[model samples]
Target: MFEKIEMMRMARALGHHASQRQIAVARNIANADTPGFKAEDVASFTDSYRAASEPLRTTDPRHLAAPDWSPADRRTLAETGVSPNGNSVSLEEEMLKGAEVKRSHDLSLGIYSSALDLMRTSIGRRA
Candidate 1:
């Protein structure tokens, strides 16, 4: 349905990414007391959307071309300076990440709503 629209499609993906980050933050917070537990973080979304997009195949003058590169959502260990007990999870960092996840989710919703409004307007309806 809405996935046909590029803006809506991207917004949905962003929302899912935000959810994944939130889970990572929660895991870090839960393991804060565990020994040798490393802080984990999901990759950021600002890494250009087209960074992993496949090269566009164009056969006519109306089409454009791009590059070929793939990016993965790697859960890499965060270096926050390990504590005496070898636990790397920091409550402060997790809290900040929680805030970031909220912002990202909000942005995703905003974009999705805006795209919907555009569609409504095109269909002769009020937003």
Candidate 2:
């Protein structure tokens, strides 16, 4: 019972994280037109996975893992182009990123739902 609950909790956490990434990607796409706007991405899944899987052994408080995006690591990789007023937002790239994030969110939801279903089956329905 406890293990089932733990699995469900982990799945929920992953789903939540993926949802945040999707939201961030959508925001980036929406702000592509504004001047001085820079595209932003949440921290990579690799970082999140590492933080979740690894045991924390930090001596200093500052060394703890961040639960969200890192502004310092954010990069503006949009191509240079002129829209009559110099802006680097690439519609193609933004669209692709948005699609990818949406897929990721769907996948996360599937995993969570499937795990919950399995747990329910294992518990067996009361007659």
Candidate 3:
């Protein structure tokens, strides 16, 4: 199955991360006027994927075990600095983030489609 492919999995993760980041950007834009609201941002997909993809190693049994990892549970953190009204959300920044997320999402979909095409070609099927 294509699920067994590492590149496929990575592409899926990239799409998911883009979705989550888009949600954060939406929330930031929606709460731009709220008092004492801080802008929220998701960690970059590259960093998160790198950390999750790395193999865990334990030199000794005494070492604390690595906990189960899932990108779905990644915590959204507040962006530093705030305006005079104590709200950190910036509409301009959110717009830029939205654009970035869109590009990432598109890239992921392209990767997935290309990989799928390759798979089909390998199986003697036309894509």
How many steric clashes between backbone atoms does each model show? 0, 0, 0
Query: Which candidate wins on TM-score?
Result: 3
- The C-alpha RMSD of each candidate to the native structure, in angstroms, is 5.5, 4.8, 3.6
When summed lDDT is taken over every stretch of 10 residues in candidate 2, the lowest stretch is 67-76
Task: Tell me each candidate's TM-score.
Answer: 0.81, 0.63, 0.83
Q: Which of the two candidates, 1 or 2, achieves a greater lDDT against the reference?
A: 1
What order do candidates take by TM-score, descending?
3, 1, 2
- How well is each residue in 1-127 modelled by candidate 1, as lDDT tens digits? 7757778868877887788889899999998999989999887675635544445667898765543222245567897989999999889989999999999999999999999899899999999
lDDT of 3 by residue, 1-127 (tens): 7667988988888888898898888988999999988888888787788888787999998998654334666656666679899999878888988999999999999999999999999999999
Question: Global lDDT of each model?
Answer: 0.80, 0.62, 0.84
- The regions of model 3 sitting more than 4 angstroms off are 55-69, 72-80
Q: TM-score for model 2?
A: 0.63
State which candidate, 1 or 2, has the greater TM-score: 1
Scored against the true structure, residue 24 in model 3 reaches a CA lDDT of 84
TM-score for predicted model 1 compared with the true structure: 0.81
